[model samples]
Target: MTHIAVLGSTNMDLVAFVEKAPQRGETVTGREFRTIPGGKGANQAVAAARAGATVSMIGAVGNDSFGARLRSTLEHSGVETDHLRTTEGSSGTAHIVVDDHGGNAIVVIPGANGTVDHLVPGDEGLIATADALLLQLEIPLAAVLAGAQAARAHGVRTILTPAPAQPLLPELLAATDLLLPNEHEAAALTGRTDPRSAALALLERVPQVVVTLGAEGSLYATRDAEPVTVPAPRVTALDTTGAGDTFAGTLAVAITEGRPMPEALAWAAAAASLSVQRAGASESMPYRPEIEARYTS
Candidate 1:
């Protein structure tokens, strides 16, 4: 089994589904309200586990009912939560609004996730044993940096998802083996809207970069070769919340299993395509067999 370590945030998602979002200072009703377990970190961990990786999650949650549900969700998805800590306050939460067309807007409350400013003693040991360490910006930057440094010290691959895009410090970039960002994030980071140009620019900071283009698939770039745009299977999307997470997690699993970059991107795309046809984050992710069937079909 492929061992993957994730050191990040865990949150309870409060979602509202509607035909269209309300304007500022205006009130509108939604079709339904639901709560789900998600946080970029938790979602990615669940994605990797569902893709057949033996995933160990290292993060913090609050001592609340939502936190309990979040923990149980990961455990149910086959993720090892031995290092998941529970703090004395509310768990992190994302106030999400999903439009009928599958687009979404979200507001994240840090809660316990903000408290994880740095790693505890056992965190490094957990990262050292993994094939790759999956990280996101939902948690504190200091903790993200510490996780990256530890992974570097242990010679473990570090895959950083620069989500909720923000300025990246130089030290963190040096420790990163792969940087994954969506097209908008790439443009925000590099000031380049064209995926190829943006990807090439990112390569100067990290050894490799993958820019996800939604239905257009993903662009892969490395210092050693020219960039390639892998195409995604065309499919109607119902919800795109977990699509990127599914892609990143499945890509990590594929790489660990020794698939070439091109083949791995294809597998990841297939997995993500399956996700968009469903609803909710984590719940939308496809399993290993499902991904294989989609890829082969």
Candidate 2:
């Protein structure tokens, strides 16, 4: 199995299902409420492990019930959490509101995740052993940069998902082997609304880019390679909370296993399609056999 390393955040997702999202300064009634173990970091780790990669997570949680649940959830999903730290405070939390149409809006409060500003000793060694390193912006930008630098030095392929989109530094972009951003994120990163143009704008900073267009598909681009578009499998989406993370994790695993880009994107799309059919974050990801069966069928 491909050894994948993820350096990111872990949060407890407090989700409320409602008929529709609340408008500005409006209070809306919700039908149900639940807490799920999540965080872009944890979600991707679980997704990759379920997709058959040997995944290790390097992140911090808080000394709280949510933290315990998050760690246990990752363990149950077959992720190695030896480097998961527990701080003496509240765990990170994401307040999410899901509409009847499966659309979601989220607000994140970084608690322990904010504390992960630097890599502790031995963290670099862990990155060195991985076939690929996955990172997200949910954690401190300093830590993300450190992880990317370590991966680059160790000759490990580095995939960066710039979520909760923010302005990225040139140094961070230079260290990224692949940049995966959703359409909105791509627009924020490159200041271009057109997916193809946005991707082209990003290539000037990173060598490779994948712009995810939810429901429609995804577009892939590399410096010397022709751009390719992969259509997503049609499915009735119940919840799309972790679909992008699922796609990124499966794509990273497939690439680490030496699958070609097109095939890997296809596999990722299939896995994401399955994830959207369910609810929650990590809980929605499908296993390797399930993904394979979906693809073969």
Q: lDDT of all the models against the reference?
A: 0.93, 0.95
Which candidate's lDDT is highest? Answer: 2
Q: In candidate 1, what are the lDDT values of residues 1-297, reduced to their tens digit?
A: 899999888888899999998889988889999898999999999999999999999999999999999999999999999899999999999999988999999999999999999989898998999999999999999999999999999999999999889999899999999999999999999999998999999998999999999999999999999999999999998888878988988899998989999999999999999999988898888899999999999
Reference-based TM-score of each model? 0.99, 0.99
lDDT, candidate 1, at 86: 93
Model 1 clashes, total count: 0
Find the 10 residues in a row with the least total lDDT in model 2.
225-234
Error of 1 at 279 (Å): 1.1
TM-score of 2: 0.99
